[model samples]
Target: MSSSAVGHVISLGCRLNLAESETIRTLIASNDVVVINSCAVTNEAVRQTRKAIRRARRERPAAQLVVTGCAAQMDPAGFTAMPEVDRVVGNAEKLLPASWTSHAPALVQDIMAVRQTAPHLAASFSAHARAFVEVQNGCDHRCTFCAIPFGRGNSRSVPAGAVVDRIAALVDAGHREIVLTGVDLTSYGPDLPGAPTLGLLIERILTRTKVERLRLSSLDGIEIDDRLFALLTQEQRMLPHVHLSLQAGDDLILKRMKRRHSRGQSVALVERLKRARPEIAIGADIIAGFPTEAEAHAANTRALIDDCDIVHAHIFPYSPRAGTPAARMPQLPPATITARAAALRASAARRRAAWLDAQRGTVQRVLVERPGDRGHAGNFAEVRLPPHEVGTIATVKIERAQDGKLIGMPA
Candidate 1:
């Protein structure tokens, strides 16, 4: 990699990481650097991070390799000890430009001590058609199975003003859609002055900016305040899609996980959402074979696909992180975990296929991601359509559902 070339940024994990990697890409002026923005959500994520470091080293032998993000923050020494890694930067320090060039072998800090969110992290320019805005960072809730809070520190939110301004900038730059990303999205605003809710921030952005389509990332169902609920059900500009961080569905498993919501509550929330906006698509994260999870627990989780009408299901076979409470609990056998995960995925696939088939012959307004290619509908359903201008919304009439996508043409 030449010094004048754009630095290679390997972003692994959630949409938040993609948004943050854009900042890292911008901060580094030389191509002689490779940054691995890692994820530590699972042991698999950490393994992939390490694999990426080795791969980058082989691909770009002369380029400096830097590791940052949750994996690096949680275990900086492990990454620094790798021969392929030149330096290791923590989640907090990764945003700082000085950390990139500093001779320090590791820039890990106590993330818990940090309180404020950097406003510059508000928008991402990496994608041509859609832009992501980071409105919140970190998490306050410590689910027994999760290690994100430790890697991300306490929850903090970007000011509504900054978010609105950044969104407006993206709108002006021709991005048709703006997605609000965060570690704990629904946990936004409690740290800010006046404790303005996420709904209020959305209201501000909609009223203050010309942003066409507004979307939200993974949200905790329990934290959906009445105001936010009203907006989600009634707002036309807010995309008709909601992705919840519903880890599991069994009441016993949920209680053991220390989650705030129950299985009944989750079902009720989805019912209410669908009743108000029938077109609203639901997505969720479900863990299969969690610690102490039984066959009944797995069945309850699988049932969520049909009960919640979950088309976009992200299933993770539980992997024990180093310090999480779940790691100490009795774990299911590896074979059992794998089988449960496959079963959950199969259930989701069947449900998703039915949902897609239901969309046949319907009309959808798609945000054209690429001209003459594909984009996504308001409900976040992927749609393949005839040629249309990139970054423009086009009305498409569904012809059929194929390969898990809606094949359409200009309506």
Candidate 2:
């Protein structure tokens, strides 16, 4: 196995996991160990985690493999049983430097007992232009299909002052954009003093920090507070793009999944956002075939793509996670799940293509994430442009749309 001063981090799962991985990388200095930040969002995710562990073992035969994150936290014994895994660390222990050097084979802790989020700051992100700061951790909601709460524990938040200070520091370090990430992002401050909301936190960041562009990770539509709604309309630094956590579009499926929002409420929220900001881009996460989902429910979910004008959609064919309530319900056939997911993805493709086409000849402010190859516009559309500095925010006049990306030249 090859060795370097810095350990390698293989991150899986959501943006929150990515942010945590950055902190883990900063904490660990060993060269002979590879950290696997695993996810257990679905059965497929666990399979992928196992595959990554095996592949890493094959490539680096002599390296010590440390498994951590949601998957390892949920089932430490399962990961410890794997021959490739030298040790299993829980989510709470993974960020600490001491845990990396400990001899314990399993360092899992009671995540539910964890009350405060540690303020782990990353000086820089590897191969990325923007910085992600974790504002909150864990979830308070118990959506039946989700096992994340068990792995992550109850909701906890970093203080608003710490978040502002971190963003200011990242900006000073030449990071132009900052993304605030969390397990349940909108559920940010209920546990903190004065119970300040997510909106208040954003307002503080924008007011106190010199961050040029601010983006939010996925948010639940039902939790869009009045302050946040107002900020969406008024704050230009807050990018004009939102990815909503709308798992299913049918009312019955939503009810079955223990989601807070109804089908009509989801549609209404999108309509409201679009009306307030005409240029905003809306994206969503929609499950294809939840257990007991019929053709009628699937059709409603399909129609929701058009109803909500969701240009960027994350369509997942439902895979039951062990111990989730939905897993015990009558399962849908594999064929039905595949077909429904395909249909939803196809619809989303058309919407994305049309959205890209509509950008032709329009001037956009794009944050050049990769010099010469790609960057994302304020509305979150990936744009291809001529070579520019990695962090340069350029004004580009889009020339054409192809392959779901917009080709643009400096304006």
| CA lDDT of every candidate | 0.90, 0.90
Tens-place lDDT per residue, model 2, 198-259, is 99999999999889999999999899988999888779999999999999889999999999
Give the clashing residue pairs of candidate 1, or none.
Answer: none
Alpha-carbon deviation at 405 in model 2, angstroms: 0.6
TM-score of each prediction: 0.97, 0.98
Candidate 1 residues lying further than 4 Å off, grouped into runs, are: 1-5, 122-126, 370-372
User: lDDT of candidate 1?
Assistant: 0.90
Model 1 agreement with the true structure over 1-411: per-residue lDDT tens digits: 444444888999999998888888888865579999999999999999999999888888888889999999999999999999999999999988898779799999999998989665634474557888889999988899999998999999999998888888888878889999999998888788899989999999999999888999999999998999999999999999999989898999999999999999999999999999999999999999899998988899999888888999999989998788999999999999999999999999999999999999899999888554899999999999888878889998999999999999888
Off by over 4 Å in 2: 1-6
